[model samples]
Target chain A: AQSVTQLDSQVPVFEEAPVELRCNYSSSVSVYLFWYVQYPNQGLQLLLKYLSGSTLVESINGFEAEFNKSQTSFHLRKPSVHISDTAEYFCAASSGGYNKLIFGAGTRLAVHP
Target chain B: EPEVTQTPSHQVTQMGQEVILRCVPISNHLYFYWYRQILGQKVEFLVSFYNNEISEKSEIFDDQFSVERPDGSNFTLKIRSTKLEDSAMYFCASSDGQGMSIQYFGAGTRLSVL
Candidate 1:
């Protein structure tokens, strides 16, 4: 069985400050990781993913997540935050190309102006 | 870019009634799935369908749930009896079935059981 754990349930950050959302997973085999963002009343959108290659993956919107095999962690970070960035973030895992995706409880990001 | 779509953006039903949620995955995708998110909880997998059959399902998908691909393009999820706990946002998603391919999601149908 595979599972995802997000360290924080809520994070409040000031606009222009850097933010990091922590995630960890438990799996017996190799896994693919992903970060998804959901805005108010909108469906979730892929923020970034880690399938293979470089450990660091980045999204177009200044968000990035690094996959750490030893730590069993894939943490999402943004260099600077904006009020508009307030949303819910989910971390998910799919081990061995089986894409059933086990998701974390999600972190509620509240970017304050 | 092609995207997954779902119908009946919101549905209100009484307890013990049956409810069907419909989805139309991307035209070329091979894997379709249904997931749900209860208020203030993480999204949970319900079932996954491939080749017109269920490939995987979660414990939450018990006797009350069934999925069908009655047509080439339409995938439907039926619940035999609606419960208040079943009230949630049901999301329909699809993937290309390629190794590590990311799943695209629909806007989701808000199911409200009275």
Candidate 2:
């Protein structure tokens, strides 16, 4: 079985400050990693994904995550954040041909002005 | 931008009543899935359907729950007998292929079992 662990349950940052949300996984086989953001009363939106190529993957919204093989981590980072960036973020991992996704408990990001 | 659509954004039903949630995935996608999130909890996978059959399902998808693709565009999830615990936000998703692994999600159906 594959599982995702997001170490932080809540992260509060001032607007325009940098932040990082840590995520780790436990999988016996190769896996795919993804970050999803959920705003209030809205569905989840894919922030970015790490399939295989480069170790670092980026999202159009200025967020990026680096896939660390040895550490089994896929931590999301942003150089600067805005109030609109406040939302619930989830880290997920999938294996076995990507048919299933195991998600973390989720991290709530609060960006204050 | 093609987006998944779900009907009855919110439904309120008494316990033991039957309820069906509907979804219309992207026109070209093949794989469809259902997930549920209880208040203050992580999202949990319920089932996955492909080629008009169930490809995978979690233990939460028991005899009380079933999915059907009644037509080309509509996918439905039926709960035979709802329980108070069944109250949650149910999300429908679809993906075009198995490799890319990017699933597009609907706004979700909020089921409130009273």
Candidate 3:
């Protein structure tokens, strides 16, 4: 079965500091990788996705992830993070077209002042 | 941006009682899905609906659970008999099912099975 792994359970960083949330996925078939963010008391929101073409994908909020097939990872990174970025980040992968997404346990990012 | 909508942000039910969680997916989306997340657990997919039928389902969606698109707008998940383990945050999501298949999720209905 396809699965996702988020190595870091929690990451704390000072505001405006660089941070990375590690995510890895395992799937026998080709997969579509995605990064979703969930704010407090809110639903999952799409941060970015890697379908094809570029090896790296960027979200509007300065977050980006690279698709590295050799490493089986799609790690989310931001050079500078804000306090608003504090939330639960989930890494997910879906195989083929329109399949169910396999999600990681999630990484909680805490941005401090 | 359009968003999926779910009714009754929270639901409380006793063990062995039946409950229905309702969702209104984005109007133009072709695929709808149900996912659940236990507190501090990974989000788990329960079922996916498309074209008035179930396209895919996970083992967690057993005989005790059923999904229905009773009307043009409402998609519902009915639990025949709720269990303590069934207490979780139920999320409804939908995607256009086009090229990328980016799904948009709604604020979930937190189901509390007492």
Candidate 4:
């Protein structure tokens, strides 16, 4: 079945350290992928997304994701994470447009000062 | 910028009781959606509303779950006779349905069915 998968459940990193949150999805047809972040008591916030055209997508908050069709992966990365980046990150996918988003199990990124 | 709004950030109810979650999507958004996340689980899609009616729904959205846009501004999800297993964080989201439409989400309402 079509689904989103976050390989890591939790990632602990020191402030100013590089981090990567691996995500993979399986879809028989074309798909749109996204990265969403959720802080404590907050809703899921769109961090970045890849619809087409570009193989790499970036967010305003210094996070980037590379979409690899061959690997069925869209892994998020940050060269240097801050303490404020501590939160649960979700990877999601949809058939396209406004279709329902299938979310991954989520990866909790804890950046320590 | 406009954002989606959901009321009653947290709700506590007893099993077998009915509960209604309210949402006000962005005024110009053409698509509305509902999703839920059980504790420590992924966010699961419940239903999607467009043109004042349900355009899509998941198996988790059974007969007991219904959605409505009673007025021009409010979209509501009603759960008839809630169950203990129904406790989850309900999220309301909306999108303009334009090119590569992006869904914006509200903070969500944490429903605890005791």
Candidate 5:
């Protein structure tokens, strides 16, 4: 079975500061990784994905994540964040050609102004 | 950009009552999926539909759950005899069914069972 684990349940950071949300996964075969963000009362939106390419993938919103195969980790990072960046972030994985994704419990990023 | 749309932003109902959640996937997409997230829980896959039929379903999707693409654009999930545990935010998503295609999600419907 495949599973995703997000290390932090809550991460608080000041505005304009950097932030990182840790995620790890356990899968026997090759996998596709994704990071999604959910704003208050909104559906999840894809932030970035790693299917097959460079280990580091970036989103238009200045967020990036690196897929580390050796450590089985895909951690999300941002050089600087704004108050508008506060949201719940989820790490997900899919394997075996099935589109169904197994998601992590999620990390709540709270940007304090 | 195209996006998935769902109806009834929120629904409240009794435990034994049946509920049908509706979704209109992106017009050109060929795959549809349903997922739910209970409060404080991770989002979970319920079912995936293709070619007007179910191609895959999770253990959480049982006999009480059914999906239909009754028309050219509308997809629906019907839950017969809802349970208290059914309370959650249900999301509808769509994809092009291509390899590594990303699924676009709808705003989701919050179901409150009493």
Candidate 6:
């Protein structure tokens, strides 16, 4: 069984401030990590994913996440946030062989201008 | 940039009523899935369909739940008898040939069982 844990339920940050949303996972087999963002009343949009290769992955919108194998963590970060960045972020994981994604309770990022 | 589409963005039904949520996945995608998110809860996978058959289902997908791909373009999830607890947002997603591919999601159907 695989499970994901997102440490913060809500995060408030000022515009241009750095922020991090922490996620951790546990799985018996190799896993793939993903970050999805949901705007109000909208569907989830894939932000970035860490399948293999580099330990770090980045999204087009300035969000990045690093996959730490030893720490069992995949924490999303943004060097600077904008008001438009406010949204619900979900951390998810799946075992390599299947498409089933185990999602963590979402973290709501509230960016203030 | 094709995307998944779901119908009846909001549904309100009395308890014990049957509800069918519909989805039209990306045209070329082969894998389909259904997931739900209760208010203030994490999203949970309900079932996955591939090759006109169910590939995997979570514990929450009991006998009361069923899925079908009645036509080449449409996929549907049926809840035989919904209870108040069944009120949630149902999301439909689809992905191309799978190993680590990202799944595209629909806007979701909000089912409200009263």
Best by DockQ: 4
DockQ per model, Cα: 0.68, 0.63, 0.78, 0.88, 0.69, 0.73
lDDT of 1 by residue, B6-97 (tens): 99999999999999999999998899999999999999999999887899999999999999999889999999999999999999999988
Residues B35-92, model 6: lDDT tens digits = 9999889999999999999999999999999999999999999999999999999999
Candidate 2: tens digits of C-alpha lDDT, residues A5-103: 999999999999999999999999889899999999999888999989999999999999999999999999999999999999999987735386788
| Runs with alpha carbons beyond 4 Å of true place in candidate 2 | A96-98
C-alpha RMSD over true interface residues, model 2: 1.8
Query: Cα miss at B8, model 2 (Å)?
Result: 1.2
Residue B82's lDDT in candidate 1: 94
Give me the TM-scores for chain A across all models, comma-separated.
0.97, 0.97, 0.98, 0.98, 0.97, 0.97
Model 5, CA-based lDDT = 0.94
Native-to-model Cα distance after best TM-score fit, residue A76 in candidate 5, in Å: 0.2
Worst 10 residues of 3 chain A by lDDT: A94-103
Deviation of model 2 at A109, angstroms: 0.2
Tens-digit per-residue lDDT, A1-113, candidate 6:
89999999999999999999999999889999999999998889999999999999999999999999999999999999999999999999988544788999999999998
Candidate 3 deviant stretches above 4 angstroms: none
Point out the higher-scoring one by lDDT: 3 or 4: 4
Clashing pairs in 5: none
Q: Over the true interface residues, superposed, what is the Cα RMSD of model 6?
A: 1.6
Clashes of each: 0, 0, 0, 0, 0, 0
After superposition, candidate 1 runs with Cα above 4 Å error = A96-98
DockQ of candidate 1 is: 0.68
Per-candidate local distance difference test: 0.93, 0.93, 0.95, 0.95, 0.94, 0.94
Cα-based TM-score, every candidate: 0.98, 0.98, 0.98, 0.98, 0.97, 0.97
Of 1 and 4, the candidate ranking higher by lDDT: 4
Give the alpha carbon lDDT tens digit for every residue of A1-113 in model 4. 67998999999999999999999999999999999999988999999999999899999989999999999999999999999999999999988777989999999999998
Ranking 1 against 5 by TM-score, winner: 1
